[model samples]
Target: MMFFCCSFMGAVAQADCLNTENLLKLDAQYETALQVGSVQFLDKLLAPEFYWVHNLASLQETKAQLLMRIKKPEAQAHQRRSHDVSAHRLGNTVVLQGLSSVDKLNPDGKTLRTSRYQFMRTYVEQQGECKLLAVQTMKVWSSEGN
Candidate 1:
């Protein structure tokens, strides 16, 4: 219930990541899905062979594992947002760099802590659509009561 709705894929199929506006929009949708545990939406956002090098988990995880974890209520973040979304086009692929902010809150909806993560994601454009290829993330830092 913490995450918002996940009807954002319409733009994903049409707007390639090479367009910064589209990239940022998808980025927002991605974070929103994570916060809400929208596994169905995530399944479509990821490519067939998508994988993630997640430092928080200390290992590489496949798309299936990622989706399974999202089904657990504990995996959903109280609040999550990604910023500094920059796209660099490389041939038909785009490498995106961004910082994600995750806030852990108490029952009163007050943030008890905040964590920042740096992530690099790859998107391969094909047939006028951008497919998410892979993502690597590392926790940059954490602060109390942010």
Candidate 2:
């Protein structure tokens, strides 16, 4: 009985893998949510255990903290774009890697700050839906560019 139960759990886990296309779609949705500062939209995409490490920092922000920051209008991204993004699938998880660029603008329509970073995000199937699990990023470059 124990062996059968374990086997069943393993099969269920194996069945939860997401395809590359779904990963790309989810990544797009996440980027749009960040640009628009849509906390409610992001809330559905990120798993409960999701955490992000920014710019190779020791500090890690959990899902709630991330959403809280996104909810603040001042912290929103004016524009964000991804370049050279690649996706890899590993069993039940999909990893996305690429260079991400973000722009911040002042109320006067001048560029306040521009930043670029290399980032990796992991997504996994949870409760029959694809959910973002974790993110790690390092600053590739940044420019005031004003």
Candidate 3:
């Protein structure tokens, strides 16, 4: 079975994006929230109308659905490690793009599977904090034995 994992890299100052630092901080917080399945943190970080598109199945989920899904007892726990993360500013919105490796875990917390993915998350400033607006992800298919 496949699952989701959240990961983030440290902030890198960028002149092009004025809110790079703030965005990076939010990103890290989001990763932590996902890692630990903190519904409250996700509630604060995601806008009411936030939408997420999964890498596999093209499944679309709302903030509420995502919260409920993650809160399930049988939900898989996994770790994500991200790299090559970068942020771009588009008007008042910030788009974070990165590559992540997700390790699916068994009941005992042992890794069962690992997959690579590329994702883009859009964020906007809301109430003096960054909130996720939308997210799109695509799995990176292995090219081995080609």
Candidate 4:
């Protein structure tokens, strides 16, 4: 019975696309949440112990602060696009690295001070769920192309 159960579990694991498809869906949801300023979804997507470092060398922010910013009107004025995103999985932990281009609008969706950036984010599984744990972002020099 134990061997059968193990085999059944292995088959289920093989059938589950949690590592690939689910991760991609989570990534898309994250971006969409940011764009629409959905604080609830953002809160659920990030881990309780999450931390983020901005490109301007600012202090890290906690999950609550991040969610609060997303709910703010000012956050709606900033637009961010992430490109060249790549993900690597080690067991249940995933690391996503990407290049980003940002445009802070002047309350009119007009691009202001376009900048390029490099970002690294870590995601881990907790309580049978995947959540973003940490992020680090650095500004790219002018020569790096915005």
> For this target, which candidate reaches the highest TM-score against the unseen true structure?
1
User: Which candidate number maximizes lDDT?
Assistant: 1
> How many residue pairs clash in model 4?
0
lDDT of 4 by residue, 55-135 (tens): 776767889988888787677525567788888988878888888765665445554656677988888876566778998
> What TM-score goes with each of the models?
0.83, 0.80, 0.76, 0.74
| Candidate 3 structure quality by residue, lDDT tens digits, 63-127 | 99989888874553467666788998877688899986666665565436666779898987654
How high a TM-score does candidate 3 get?
0.76
lDDT of 2 by residue, 1-146 (tens): 32333333344334543666546655766776788777766776788999899976856799999998887888788888887899888777888999899887866766567889899999888766677899998887878642
Estimate the TM-score for candidate 2.
Answer: 0.80
Regions more than 4 Å wrong, model 2: 1-17, 106-109
- Please write out the lDDT profile of model 1 over residues 27-131, one tens digit for every residue: 677788878888877787788899999876688878898899989876788889888778888688888898998877655665457789899989787777666
> How many steric overlaps does candidate 1 have?
0
Show the lowest summed lDDT stretch of 10 residues, model 1: 1-10
Model 1 CA deviation exceeding 4 Å by range: 1-7, 105-111, 144-146
What's the candidate order when arranged by decreasing TM-score? 1, 2, 3, 4
Give the whole-model CA lDDT for all candidates, comma-separated: 0.78, 0.76, 0.68, 0.69
Candidate 4 lDDT score at position 96: 84
Ranking by lDDT: 1, 2, 4, 3
